[model samples]
Target: MRALQQCLTLAWRSLVQVRHNPWELGDYSIQPILFLVLFLFVFGGAVAGSTEDYLSFILPGVIVMNLVFVTVYVGHGLNSDLTKGVFDRLRALPIPRWAPLAGRILADMVKQVLCILLLLGVGFLLGFRMEAPWWGLPVMIVLLLAFALSFSWVMVLVGVMSRDPEHVQLFGFTALFPVTFVSNAFVPLETLPSWLQTLVALNPVTMLVDSCRGLLSGGPVLGPALGALVWAAIITAIFAPLSVRALNRRLMGQGGAA
Candidate 1:
């Protein structure tokens, strides 16, 4: 219980930093809206016959893509704290070792929620409507957050290993671009060649986007949703321990240097 309180306190600290550093918020807000508008207008007609028709298709996808991309901030912020000596100060406290990491992740989940809602609002303004039941929205949020939480562990590992925050962001986005763009996020699966379609079908990003589409607009919900969850499980199982270990090693090295 005490650890949970510490986590919340640290989470609040992270969120409060946004007041002094508003540009961080812009990454979550402006970039996503720009992606939504550009894709919806530029490729909508050629891809889906009209912007209205494409809005439904692309909104959920953009949400997923944006969610994945936004996770880079977790690594960036962690790397910044490490390099800036914030974690060193926190280490003197009696709090649990994991609290800082948990707190940052909790704060990240909050940002994810805000980003999701913002995109949904913009999507609605652009004529996107939810065809699935109201419960689907909440369910989708849970699923997306779950996947994001798991995926952030990968970035957390990156943060612990990288020498600086810039490197973290560079590695994060460089890898994510191909992972996201190669999926069915911006285009339909059938439009691709058979070989590419097969690969994209197996891509976890494709599974995630398909799940989001299922939960929001109406489609085969169970298979894609389950597949996404499986992917999340695999990611968490693999990366969570690795990240924690790397963080501990990095902190120990810093202590030795001091």
Candidate 2:
């Protein structure tokens, strides 16, 4: 119970930082809205025949893409804190060691929820509608967040090993851009070459985008959703322990240096 309280307190602290650093909020707000609008207008006719159709198709993909991109902040912020000695100060407190990580992740989830709603609102104004039942919306959100939580560990590991916050962002986005785009996020798999189709079909981002589309605009739900969950499990299994160990070693090295 006490640990939970500490986690919440640290989460609140992370949230409060946005007020003092207002530009950080723009990453979650302005950037996503721009992506949605630009994609809908630029590729709508060529890809999906109309703005409205493309809106429905791209919105879910945008959400998934944005969610993946946003996880980079976990690494960026953690790397910043580590470099700035904020984690060192937090370590002086009696709170559980995991609480800081949990708190940042919790705060990130809040940001993710806000970003999702913002995109949905813009998507609605742009003529995107949810074809699935109401429950599907919440389920989609849960699935996206669950995947984000698992994936954040990978970034956390990156953050731990990165020399500074800038490197974390550089590496995160450099790697993520290709991974998100090479998949069928913006276009149907059938449009791609047969050779590329098989590989994109295997990309986890394709599964996630397909699952989000199923949950939102109506399509095959179970298979893609299950694939996404399995991918999330595999990622967490591989990266979570590595992140924790790396964090411990980094902190211990810092302590020893002091």
Candidate 3:
């Protein structure tokens, strides 16, 4: 109970900080809308038959992509807090070591919700609609949020390990771009070579995307959804404690070797 309260307090402060910094929202809000519009309008017919078809195919991928990129910035936040000694100050408090990380993750989740709404609004304007029932919508959103949280653990690790936040941005793009695009983002897995297809089929990103599309289209979803959940659980189990330990070690004046 105490840890949860501390987390909420820290999360609220982090949100206020975000409100004061308009640039963060702009980057998350504007960029996804721009990319979705440009790709659906300009390249839809060339690649995916029509705008409507492309929207159905691409909207799921777009949402996943947005979440993936947004979570990457968690690393930047971590790096900034460390360099500015905010983390060091937090360490002096009686709060749990995981409290601040939990708080930041929650704040990022709220930002993600806003981002998804903006993207969905833009997508609707572009003629995107899910054929599934109303109940399915919330389920899809929950699954996507879970996937985002699972992925954020890795970002937290990177942020804890980074000595310089500036270079973290470059490393984020370099690492995430390949994992994202190489999945079932743009093209159908059937279209890829056997080896590439195998990789995409095994990619957790692809499973999440597939599950989301299934929920949206009212298609069968037993496999992809289950697979995504299992992967998320495994990732959380492995990284959450490691992250806590890393933060504690860092606060003790240990290097960022973790």
lDDT of each: 0.94, 0.93, 0.84
Better of 1 and 3 by TM-score: 1
Encode model 1's per-residue lDDT on 201-224: one tens digit a residue: 988889989988988989988899
**lDDT of prediction 1:** 0.94
Clashing pairs in 3: none
Q: Which ten residues in a row have the lowest lDDT in candidate 1?
A: 125-134
- Tell me the tens digit of each residue's lDDT in model 3 across 1-258: 988999999888878997678898876898888778887888789878898788988888888888898887788888788878898778779998778888999989899888887887888888888798877778888998998898888888778877888767778778899888999877788878997898899888899889888888767677999999999999888887787677677777733432
User: For residues 144-244, what per-residue lDDT tens digits would candidate 2 score against the true structure?
Assistant: 99999998998999899999989999999998899899999999999999999999998888998999998888899899989889999999999999999
- The TM-scores of all predictions, comma-separated, are 0.99, 0.98, 0.94
The Cα error of candidate 2 at residue 43, in Å, is 0.6
List candidate 3 stretches off by more than 4 Å. Answer: 254-258
Instruction: State residue 102's C-alpha deviation in candidate 3, in Å.
Output: 0.6
lDDT score, candidate 2, position 38: 96
**Candidate 1 local Cα displacement, residue 11, angstroms:** 0.4
RMSD for each model, in Å, please? 0.7, 0.8, 2.3
